[model samples]
Target: MTFSSSYLFSLTTFIYMGAAALYLIHWIFRVKKVGFLATVVTVGGIVIQTVGIGLRWIESYQLGYGHAPLSNLYESLVFFSWVTIVVYLIIEWQVKQRVIGAFATPFASLSMAYASFSPNIEDKIQPLIPALKSNWLIAHVVTCFLGYASFAVACGLGIMYLIKNRFSGASEGIMGVIPDCKILDELIHQTIVFGFLWLTLGIITGAIWANDAWGTYWSWDPKETWSLITWFVYATALHARFVRGWAGRRIAYISIIGFASVMFTYFGVNFLLSGLHSYGAQ
Candidate 1:
């Protein structure tokens, strides 16, 4: 990577960290201006992040081997963070709620910083192996990570929901800053629904890609199994919400568990288990 690109990445990391801190203060103090400032800083960080990714892409070409940056764990994680922020921004805009971004931005910033700084994670662009030399790779990975990002937002909302619920009955100082429990519950449900749709599409795309590349649509690989498990968890959540009239704390708890599965699918399968997706790690 060029020095300029590395510097841009570093700058973005710092901005995100600052934004997260601002958002946290807003949450704790119930200060609207702090949240607004946090949003501004977060947007600035995202713009810098976009430039950084673009510079990395350009640098890849300069190295005489052109490939999208989604090939490895580090790049994927950075892209995942980007997607999470994008999705969170959209939700924040739609709901007019700055509180969720308070939780989401820190996670995004932290993940990006981890990917950028971890010595074990290689930042160099490399040629794709023969197995990965297909268009399906991009589609499959993007969809999967988008799904993961959506669930990450859902997880944040779930956390807020639990906190809101804990203080629902009591007139605590912090409770005044949070939205109503009903609103939190609804937000959690909406995020889960959005995440579930993307996750379903992601899984289907992966299955199709696997069939094209390896002649098997469904192999019980660790990654695949974990993804299936995540699907089931959210599927159950959806059913309970729509069919069984489940809401509030129960659904919030499910969202938490669903996101935990998302983490396991993303990280656990990469490190804790062996599978066809092991090559995903850089």
Candidate 2:
């Protein structure tokens, strides 16, 4: 086993926790330096996580497994955390919003912590099952997790909206630090749109992969079925916002609900339901 990857990931989890704390401090105290510290720590964590993923990929090659570091549950969760932070950082940079980090970073930290601490998860590098030994594996997994990461960010924004709307009539105090409700609403819409596109690609790639392995394009497996369900949820959200003039609390609630569908597609399908995608549970 390559210890480096595990070590880096463990460090990443704690660093994320620290970053989250810093973000909250910045929000509560209105301290500019603390917010910058949070941003620096999160960016540093992302850099370390990139290195860790690379090391894990190399170790898989050395073990002769010869696949991306995405064959099982542990690595997927790690990648989900990684990309969530990446997307969040880009948003933070462009929008100049640090309070979102207070909501977003904990999801990244929690993903890593669960992957590291959960007894049901294993961190070993293993050869792919015969069905997964295809080029589509990487494409499907990466796109799906990118989509998942965006949904995670959107969900965090949803929480922020709820909190901001529930209080702060004048947009003062902690609410003053957060972006405006209208801005959060726009961000939530945009994030879900980004996620929707990638998720479409992920599902298409999975269909192609299934065809190559099983001679069928759509099997209606629990995973595939639920993925379609999640897709429709986001599609409806987008439609409602653009066509139906939905905004604010309604969009925020739907974003949170959409993420719940995402979580079920990613996690529930593996443990609570079973099908060809059961390999992920390993």
Candidate 3:
């Protein structure tokens, strides 16, 4: 009768997987009911995952750490999955489309899967380090992951646009369920702009936190350096879209590229490089 954080998280992972599978089936078979069911499953996954995250936060307190569940790779991955679902659902609601779930929910599912099953990631709660003790921890992590989640949704939309365009006439079976390329393109641009703003806030808050913790706002650490790089990549994407009148495949390409940068800034820097933010690798 008792559900621990781990138990709920494990259950949520399977729920996301089911959502992803249902979305894919809906997309491939053009089943309207399946699409509706997919949305329901995704919503269910989000609710359960939200409760699981809350339980984990409480468990941390029980363990004497008393911190938000955003400390280590396992926790970050878990929160990242949650935020990605939230961002995707908002887009689905605005566009009145469920097809994007095929592309978007998989990102959430994979994130949760990795967090729950990865051998290298530890799900145990630990006390925050001196630097992470600041209140900015929540703001910085939340904003950064929100931005990351938005970019992830944009990337999914971009992929959807490309698929719809690529199989325009020949593969009606697959493309028929997808939205128009124009709509996908517009959504991609809108999501990119949203992500860019959040990423900017994330970087700003991180700098403030860094200054408070390390006496410098800009240390050019590996993580900080890569974060700046990732920012510029998206900035250039937006600049090209706005000034050059670039849209369609160009913007789609940039969305994919920008997400690659985001992945690097998030995972690569944490694992492959060393920096003040290396505590995140824990």
Q: How do all models score by TM-score? A: 0.95, 0.97, 0.97
What is the alpha-carbon lDDT for the whole of candidate 1?
0.84
Candidate 1, residue 215: how far the Cα is off, in Å: 0.8
Query: Model 1, 32: alpha-carbon shift in Å?
Result: 2.2
Badly placed stretches (over 4 Å) of model 3 are 243-245
**TM-score of model number 2:** 0.97
Error of 3 at 190 (Å): 0.5
Taking the tens digit of each residue's C-alpha lDDT, what string does model 1 give over 1-282? 346666787788788889889989988898889989999998888898888888877877888867777888878878898888899999889998887877788779888888888897877778788778788877888888888888888888888888877777866576676778778778877888888888998899899988988999899999999999999999988888766557677888888899899989988888889899987666
Per candidate, the number of residue pairs that clash is 0, 0, 0
Model 2 lDDT per residue over 1-282, tens place: 446888999989899989999998998999999999999999999999999999999988988887899989999999999999999999999899999999999899999999999998988888888888899989999999999999999999999998888885856777777888888989999999999999999999999998999999899999999999999988988888766557778889988999999999999999999899998898
Screening candidate 2 with a backbone cut-off below 3 angstroms (N, C-alpha, C), the clashing residue pairs are: none
- Model 1 scores a TM of 0.95
**lDDT tens string, model 3, 1-282?**
369888999999999999999999998888999999999999999999999999999989988889999988989999999999999999899888988999999999999999888898888888888878999999999999999999999999889888888887854677777888888888998999999999999999999998898899998999888889889988887888666557688889889999999999999998998878888787
Q: lDDT of each model, Cα atoms only?
A: 0.84, 0.91, 0.90
